[model samples]
Target: MTEATHDDRHPMTGNRTDAGVDTGIERHEYDVVVIGAGGAGLRAAIAAHDAGARVAIVCKSLLGKAHTVMAEGGIAAAMGNLYADDNWRVHFRDTMRGGKMLNNWRMAQLHAQEAPERVLELEEWGALFDRTADGLISQRDFGGHRYARLAHVGDRTGLEMIRTLQQRAVDLDIDVFMEFTVTELFRDPSTGSGGTGGRISGAFGYWRETGRFVVFESPTVVLATGGIGKSYQVTSNSWEYTGDGHALAMRAGASLINMEFVQFHPTGMVWPPSVKGLLVTESVRGDGGVLKNAEGERFMFDYIPEFFKKETADTIEEAEGWYTDKKNHRRPPELLPRDEVARAINSEIKAGRGSPHGGVYLDIASRRSPDFIRRRLPSMYHQFKELADVDITQEPMEVGPTCHYVMGGVEVDADTEQSIVEGLYAAGEVAGGMHGSNRLGGNSLSDLLVFGRRAGHNAAYHSMRTKQRPTVSAEQVKAASAAALHPFEVEGGENPYTIQTDLQDVMQRLVGIIRTEAELRDSLAEIERLKERAKRLSVEGHRQYNPGWHLALDLANMLVVSECIAKAALERQESRGGHTRDDYPTPDDGWGALNLVLTLPSDSDSVDLKHQPLPVMPDDLKTLFEES
Candidate 1:
């Protein structure tokens, strides 16, 4: 309800006790250290540990509290439980089409092929999915999937996923540093590691509870820190998703691709101001819920994109038939990729057909039975009942768009998940190119599963085989510690919270869902102002349980990421998927063929953007798209 403040109970800062005046640093060593405790981080740690290496999982929050735990919907995998005709090729085709063909071809192929095995592995490791009559893992329909393809535990799929992965990591004896925030990644070129130039040496950070600096010396680091939704005022993401991994990779000399695309999910709560942007799962619409404007018109049919026209239903009757007989009828427009649905919702509201709460109406009450609603979407029912006091099985809910995911992040090798910066690897939401311009619902969970394992496996091999482990020098650690504590050293400077709020305002107003060149340029100018203010930002409290201090550190990451988003948006002058341009309203073939790449020059803090050609797809894979 209130604006984001330093006083909120922060996940990174656990209960703090006075370690009084003890500034002494702590140090540890590992072959690989995974930063983040979400699904990807846990999976990566487990894999690296299994690969005969010392692995550590460091996180900003307590175990099981990562942003992945908040994911609704389900993990997408073509297990064909509900439809025997379904397979990986179909899943791949759906993904590429959903992403508007800008996705990295190799990554999409790998994700589709490996997702099934990953989901089955989780099932083997005690992840209980809803089962079909034949006892196979039940797959549920989600937007952009051609078949029932999401393996789930009702609507709380992410909670089940994180719990299973967390338990597996614990059973595998992986070391975990809870409530620690990694502020800088250290790369030592002088160690003569077995990679080009310099390899990842280690990470420098602090214990959130004690504020004491710590260092972990390692040959490899896996950055699984999640999305950049915290940069927006209204988001489905938690407070922790402040572009940490993306910023860390950029600062460590990696390039970021397609930084313009940010996904705003179609159905977020739009009432009661406080919970306005809280997510309303796609599973509701997948299960036959309808979207309507204030005039009681099913508005989605009128807003269907030409790209999806051939496969989507044109009438309400045809769309309704799909829930009961998917084999014969086309999917509803409401089931279009998130970008289309979000834009449609925005249009309805802007045209003054919005609900009393300033959003469109989503009604499942008139379609599905009360028992079916409760059984399939239990979390949705409870979320609305408790948070908004509106029983979803009885009436329509006010819903609109909210910033949910980013399709762009650190660019990495499709095969190894290694960024341009040698020993640094990335996967999940932090790695770009997998989702392209727009990500399909349910695809993110699968992306995490498929690539997380790959990143961990390769990072471990790289660490173990390095002739000698790289070490972080005392000087490097001291410099990092000084930079982190600089906010406390400054006096009478701008408040970090003010700079953060200002940055969010600029992003939401100018660089959000729909953008133009002038607005993006303005956003960049504002971001520069914020960056200057951030450098002079001051924090009053000591680091122990100090949310103000944490904000100061996170503000730097947000500013860099915000600039990346705005600059990339400006470079790609066409509307496509998540990166919709108000002026240049159509997708351009030339722009689609090239990606905007952002690299940070070593000599300067500013980021430079360039256009890079996309990789050519293999003929075998190209033929898949030609098939009817």
Candidate 2:
């Protein structure tokens, strides 16, 4: 799979370096270029091909190995397998409420309506989901859902989903360029691919292995490059999530919305420093796990959901002494209630009642039988035993907050998924307005499929309808190539890894789950200072397979995105959904109606923040909220 396009018309090598790209650089042409081959990118490519477009998928990692594989929860869709009364309307209502009503109603509506079809489509493409006694695809309940709506393959649903999508892609012969890092997106290229006067032109990147440049000229581009979690010090995301898509969209002149809304999962592994921040899936709590602080007290009774507090509040007094009883841990059991659990752990840690590793204790050992633990959670059992030397059936696991996903990203048209830049599109975690302020546990997979299909089909149609071809700017390509190589040219300078670590620390501490204006302002100052120092980062080795050079390139993206998060968090002045502002402390009605958008102007290096009115939900849709 070395720099080659797979198709009937192309050679086995498949690579078309002959596109006359500035000698030595490989170049090719396609109708649509889909970057980031995660679930969304793969789905988008499949959709583009079905819409009669020659599609190419460019990914930072090998195909089927995108961060989507790390997803532990099942895909959310109202299939009605387990719950006969479940339907799209109910799912839509749950999604809107879960996102605290900041979600674009149109996107949420479409996602809810189309998710079931997408799940079935995956099945048709050879995905094998766990089935019920009736032999229909099994659905499980997740946080914020009223019924069993998630169709899963145990907890490894994401891995299976990717495998199915990847195999489907193989059967379709969609050209996949694996291990390619796209550093720059070229808009309106002038001297297009290889002097081929009327050639496809848009993207410029490089192979991670050889370090040689590669360009793809396409009329339509879909950015499914995932989230900005890697910018934080503690995260469950992989190394590739350095906000490449977010930064590329900004550079391509697209705006980002809700940049401050980053989701921090409640329980990431906190022991054995080497495996810290690894996600201890919510399933542990779902299948009976208890949260305790250093004082050996089971503390969930203190943090039940506000809605259920009245009924459960009185029981708290009765349940207080029951902490001595092992079987009583699951008594109040409103389910771990993700938001409340995270808040409770943070509170304990802040009060210095945390575990030795600075996290609350999630004990499943005394509550569940060893056999039940192994049967229900094979992954969790091994994840703890192998990674941290902690046996879930024997001991409590240290858990804390770790950045998981971002609800903020490139704002796009609800239906078409196109960005401010006409042909540029985004989906999955890279596209916002769908998840709005906060995302539900299983909604991420559904969002990827629903918007991925829309983005691909629409981008392909946009390509088909265009009368004049857009060329990639040669100057932009040359400049991008130069920037990729500059670190090797520097003599004495800062180390990219050091700068990246510092940036992550700044983001994790200041612009994290809890925020304040002064901390955000200080983060901004530190980011600006890092931005200046990053200009002088030097590489110890040549570009070929050089990790240092990669970080140097990624540093710019992390810096810019960190700036966006910090600036947006600073401006919002209110706590809502995933953006928790310590200073403001509560959601403001005015802020609820307005979305914060950050756009990078070509003339300036800094991003400019502005407020945009959220699209009004139609009367018919608004009535759903008013209804029971």
Candidate 3:
């Protein structure tokens, strides 16, 4: 691969005439419009409504089926009574350690402290978390948590949580605009003249079912859109996880932090090619499953590093001891943090101990009885049975790491959840600086609830205190509509599915669990090629609910975000957390404390990389840690 200098041109702003499509068009309007309807968006809408603002949640899927429904594990919270040692401080420390200390201290601090209240609020709104004999919420152990701090309702935690929030939002009469895809943000032209400059006035998108363009005119817009795992070939993320919010925010000139740190879950099923990369939740390992090679040898012991060495057991006896007496000993070997576990699996495969499939075996059949396994891992049993024709109760399941979550995204203030953009806010996976480099397993759910509500409340407050600048002009709306429709108008030269598949293959090969300078360079070249293909991409059918056409548009966003990741990875010359560059090999102490900011180019598709000074913790904030 050839090394190329970064271009400062806005690739999305090129002339459309070359592609045989018109670019000129009209704009549409809303009071408060949210692009995603997952846990974050639902929570945001609810908070906005309580703040006395009219809100509408526009989503790409049905109410509950958004990716949040697929989150099987649980939400992390500091409901302290479950484990006496577990508190907000411990939670914060575990989060920072899990993220390799690259996290925004303020975001991690706030998330750890406020998460319990959010979880309890869900309970008040009718979420039925599993309860102990004392009737308090039951807690479960997950990867990276020092204590059992995840509140759950069996394996369907996200489903239960989203359902509760959705029901509550309905009771409050928040408008639900399902099957709508936001394509662009509309800034008031008059803002630069007399009003608050650089504030997002509203947003616009197409209604999939109606095949019509819809515009929302609001002083505030909250982006709760999720991760970019869909950019990888083998991922656990749903179609909705296309990094829409990240792309939109970047395009609107909001700074993105830590775009390179993507988390890869250690145990995705790896078998028949069709279901090879589906997520096998950490709940499997949480229930006593061990990672073993085809030789039936457990391998994690050899790979435990100093950071987790004390917290991880080596011998089988020590592992069993740790499981039984977790407080006195380390966590069970099976429950090591995700990055460690994934690296262990990688070593196993590299050393020729891998299973028939290019993956290792995660077996619980030998550890637990079939009846107990059936009761606890019903979904795993059913998933393998339906998708791969295998049953976990009867056999060892093959598993490997698949791209799962992005630890990087739009930068936001820890307390306000506001992006650098004045009227813009972000939460959930789209907002960054919380997880840092590697996210703990259960923290994501809690982060969404905690920060999502904060974003909503803050956005509503900004909306109430400020006035709308000006309505979007007809020329602006027409241009956006034309741009939204361009892919459909082009004659067939490229298939979106083919382009997407190629893009994913490139990402998986170059930016997978491991990385090197050579691979990173190759990945950047591949991204540029894919971007060229995307420009000529065409789709079958009209602007109606056409998945193919929608994918074409999504491909552009994914490519842009992927480029940001590659570029950021290239700039960060250290191996801290998820961004382990073989060439760099070790973390730089001076660089470790800084945040990498990827600012969008004023005229092009490339991102400008710069190191921003991390915020220092004040005495009052430091005191919160001491109190805990």
Candidate 4:
């Protein structure tokens, strides 16, 4: 993408517009405004409307285009379709263990207990999930689950999820503002209604299509924006995942927990450069695929962690038996949680056992019939054929780690999904403490449905019962507008794209999967430098369909988030779940009990990190883990 010329344009001015694009500031009001259009946002909006509130859904992309569609495995829920022994208690135990027990116990409990209902609700709302012999929704296997517990629509489960949620939203008549990017979340003036000094007032953003500013005056705001993967170069996240919600919450005085826990999925494509980091879903392994290195040997058995050794197979024959008879044989090491698999892949590649493309091989062709592969993993077949000209039905695919999701985000009340800031709520991937450290493949969809509904229900209730609604202050809007136009105001400044590239380089090289003190510290120092460089950024073109200008706006958010990750990574010395430290190399008991939470005080230039204790699981819940 080439930069546009200045060509006699005035700074901080966007009066002109191309055909079919609007100009000037626009305003609207709603009882609740959700600042994303993913599974979480759509579910939240529907809940708000059900509660008799006028809701609005604002998004950076068109409806049904949120990164939720990128999910391939399925929506996880212990629906007991295949295994009558499967239940919420077992699901809860699997979730907690997969996260290395760092998950908020209550949140995990709620997610496990409510996931089945949520999936069934989706089916009722017209999600076309694959069915079993008895016509029940099919459940598939995924890493870390005790039973086959993913409700899926073959490999296009995420697509069907977003489609169903979007249609449900459309049928409810909820308002939507597509292609609007929210840059700043606003709050009431100190002297405000209901005497609540820091209640949510509204949100501010510009239209990507029209380059015009729009404001929504609302009493409550739900931040359902997804992960922070785009901050890294190699990622499964779409272009939209720039840590927007995480940064927005921190900027608005909310705290983020476990900021260092970044999940790198094990099976991203690693070929042809262009689609190198694209996701190759966990379903490949869930069905029967094995990981092999250059020696054509299954390498996962050599890297199984002690934590999962009890349930994982040590022999190839036992592991193979699991595909056909799960009750008698142990699961394969290939079915270990994502962190272990990704790290094993990294180890193999580092030891010169990598594929020609610098990754390992995921071989499903040798295990399953061609028809079974196509019927189950159709998306994987098509993605491979079109992108790399390698047919998955005939050969193994080159795969490696890619920054996929962040377990860290806005810390919220486990039950209500409300942040410390009144009227500001978060859910789905944007909320912290759900998947403590490493997330299992299918649980993300379940998390979206459960907590998204909680956030929406609470936000709507809060908006309706509050005696008076706070008004957005003019001063706040002016400050936000100035910050938004910073890149344009500076003359002869550095290019925003250059800053983005540099930021990605630093993150991928230093703060990525395997981190160290020196690397994280160096990352922080570079982040500080990048922040300074970002302030002087310049974009030559108007915002209307300007990818360069839009990215310029997303730069500040990325910088703040990268700093949070680096600082948190530096603070936690021991390895656990997603945040692995090369120096420390193992989990520390004291560190495991504690969490690193970061917050950005409005008056401060730097974020403050503090040690907080993880919530203790209740006695009744602890028994679930104790049972063999």
Model 4, 1-628: lDDT tens digits are 2323332221124333231222235667899999999999999999999998999998888898999999989999999999999999999999999998999999999999999999999999999999999999999889989888999999999999999999999999888888889998888756233212477889999878656667788989999999999899999999999999999888877889998999999999999799989999999998999999999988887886666555443434644534222245357678889999999999999999999999999999999999999999999999999999999999999999999999999999999999888889999999999998889989999999999999999999999987888888767777877787767667789898899999999999999889988888899999999998887888776656778779988987898999999999999989999999999999888998887899887777698999999999999999987776
Model 1 over residues 499-595: C-alpha lDDT tens digits? 8888889999999989989999999998998888888988887778788999899989999999999999998989999999999999999998988
Question: What order do candidates take by lDDT, descending?
Answer: 4, 1, 2, 3
Q: Where's the lowest-lDDT run of ten residues in candidate 4?
A: 3-12
lDDT for each residue of candidate 3 in 508-547, tens digit (9 for 90 to 100): 9888877888899999999999888888888767555578
Per residue, candidate 2 scores C-alpha lDDT tens digits across 1-628 of 1323322222226544553436566778898999999999999999999999999999998888899887766899998998787899989998887787889989999999999999999999889888999899988766667676888887788899999999989999998888888988776634323111222347888878767787788888999999998898889899899999999989877889989988888899987787778887776765667778999987776665555443232345435322111212223332433555676789889999999999998888888899988876778899889988888899999999899899999999999998877788899999999987888878989988999999999989989987777876667678988888888888789999899989889998888888998999999999999999998998876666788888899889999999999999999988778888888987888999988999988888999999999999999988876655
Clashing residue pair totals per candidate (backbone < 3 A): 1, 9, 16, 0
In model 4, pairs of residues that clash are none
RMSD of 2: 4.9
CA deviation > 4 Å runs, candidate 3: 1-29, 192-197, 310-316, 319-327, 618-628
CA lDDT of each prediction against the hidden true structure:
0.87, 0.83, 0.80, 0.88
RMSD (Cα, Å) for all candidates, in order, is 4.5, 4.9, 7.2, 4.3
From the highest TM-score down, the ranking of the candidates is 1, 4, 2, 3
TM-score preference between candidates 2 and 3, better one:
2
